[model samples]
Target: MAILIYTQNYDGKFKKSVFELVTYGAAVAKELGTEVTAVTTGKLDTETLKELGKYGAEKIITITNEELNDFSAQAYAYAIEQVAKKINADLIIFGNNPYGRAIAPRLSVKLNAGLAAGVTALPSSVSPFTVKKRVFSGKAFADVVIKSETKIITLNQNSYKVEENPVDISTEEFTAEIPEGAYAVKPIETVKSSGKMSVTDAEILVSGGRGLKGPENWGMIEEMAEILGAGTSCSRPVSDLDWRPHEEHVGQTGKVVAPNLYIAIGISGAIQHLAGVNGSKVMVVINTDPEAPFFEAADYGIIGDAFEVVPKLNEAFKKFKAEN
Candidate 1:
């Protein structure tokens, strides 16, 4: 039995989350007395694929079929299933992101494997294969065991730490049978961001909410994000009001994030909102109201107006970045 990790590439580069998954899968492989293999589909440079070795991937399988260029839930699942079967992977790992969400469940059903998504920790015990996972939109944690002979896990981003265990990785090309009508629905347009970190992959996140008053006042927040090299996000109300895109929204009804540092500006810590971000390693809440619930969950709190406080914070951050 081998541990197979499905690595994803966006705009020709592997995101940090992929390496984290590889590291976690490598640890699992070690415990099972097996090796980790990484499988990826897309057009990527050989050098980029070899980097998985540092994360303990012994071999990297590249599926270079043109049909696999763009993401299709059914097609991708079938392709990965083929590789999983060839390698006899008893344990499969995926990122708990949009791409993984689209394909993991399909692959799980195809392989008849018990699946555990949004996993936050490695298996506490391998014999029973119990793992901790987030429940109720990250508000709670539950330990689950997969009684199936094969298990598939979709890891929550930032939950696992990435460590380098460099090895000489071998690469080979593999082909899979693509089901008919798999790519029936093709994207009409694909807009890719240039040199911007996605909120999901960002280490530090600078999030704003209705407290900003208006979307026009986002300059300070954007400036602060630029200075800190962080990603920008918004509260649910901001998205509901169309002040920001829905993708930027983070809450119980939106994306769940666990960045290393999450800075909330003008956002009241509602239970729904808190449920999404409570997994953050460190949280800083800046709000005018001292009674804001965000402060209760924050490692640091600033009871002040965001308009005045944010500009000052941006200046301070700029100076600190320059001096340090």
Candidate 2:
């Protein structure tokens, strides 16, 4: 039996989350007294694939099917299922991102394996595989037990620390036999954001709410994000009003993020909003209302006008950066 990790790449390059998944998979393999085999698809060089070995992938397999150039959940799931069967993988792992969310359920059904998504830790017991995960929008925790012989799990982003445990690695190329209908729904075009840190990947985020007043005033928010080397985000209402793109929205119905630091300007903390960002390590709220709900959830709060507070805070950050 082997542990298999599905490492997703963007534009033929692996991201930090891929390394984290590999590291987590390696730890799980050690726990189960097995070895880890990572699988991916796309046109990536051998040197680029070798990096997975630094985090405990004993072998890396790349699916070189030209039809898989664009992501289709059904096609990707079928490819991974084939790989798992070929390697006799008992435990399959994926990062709890969009790809994992879409593909894990289908793969689980196809493999007839029990699945646990948003897993936050390693199995407490191998005899009856159990995992802890956040539920109720990060407001509570649940320990789920998977009883299937072959199991699948999607690890929550940033929940497990990334560690290096090097091992000698080998690579292989597999071309999956995808049927004709697999590409029933193919992407016609893909537009990628250029020269900006993705909110989901950012360690630090400067997010604005309706308190920023208007889209015209977003220059200060952009300035703050640039000064801090952080990503810019906005609340649901701000996005709804077209002050920012919907992609920048974060909340219950928007993107869920767990950054190291999240700065909220002019946002009153609603439960829906908090549910999405409460995973942040540290939250700072700056608002004019002393009783703003965000203050209750913030690690630090400044009860003053954002217009006055933001400029001063930006200057302070600049000074701090210059000095140190």
Which 10-residue span in candidate 1 carries the lowest summed lDDT?
A: 191-200
Error of 2 at 210 (Å): 0.8
User: For residues 1-324, could you state the per-residue lDDT of candidate 2 as single tens digits?
Assistant: 699999998888999999999999999888888999999998889888889999999999999998888888999988999999999999999899999998999999999999999898888878788999889998998999998989999998877888999999999999998888887896888787765888899889999999888999999899999999999999999999999988899998999998889999999999999999998999999999998999999999999999999999999999998998
Error of 1 at 229 (Å): 0.5
TM-score of 1: 0.96
User: What tens-digit string does per-residue lDDT give for candidate 1 at 1-324?
Assistant: 789999998767887899999999989888889999999987778889888998899999988888887779999998999999999999999999998999999998999999999999889999898999998877689999999998999999999999998989999899889978899878788876654677787889999999999999998988999999999989999999999878788888888889999999999999999988899999999999999989999999999999889999999999999999
Tell me the spans in candidate 2 whose CA falls farther than 4 Å from its real position: none
Candidate 2 clashes between residue pairs 3 or more apart in a chain or in different chains: none
Task: Quote the positional error of residue 16 for candidate 1 in Å.
Answer: 0.8
Stretches of candidate 1 off by over 4 Å are: 193-195
> Candidate 1: which pairs clash?
none
How many times do residue backbones clash in model 1? 0
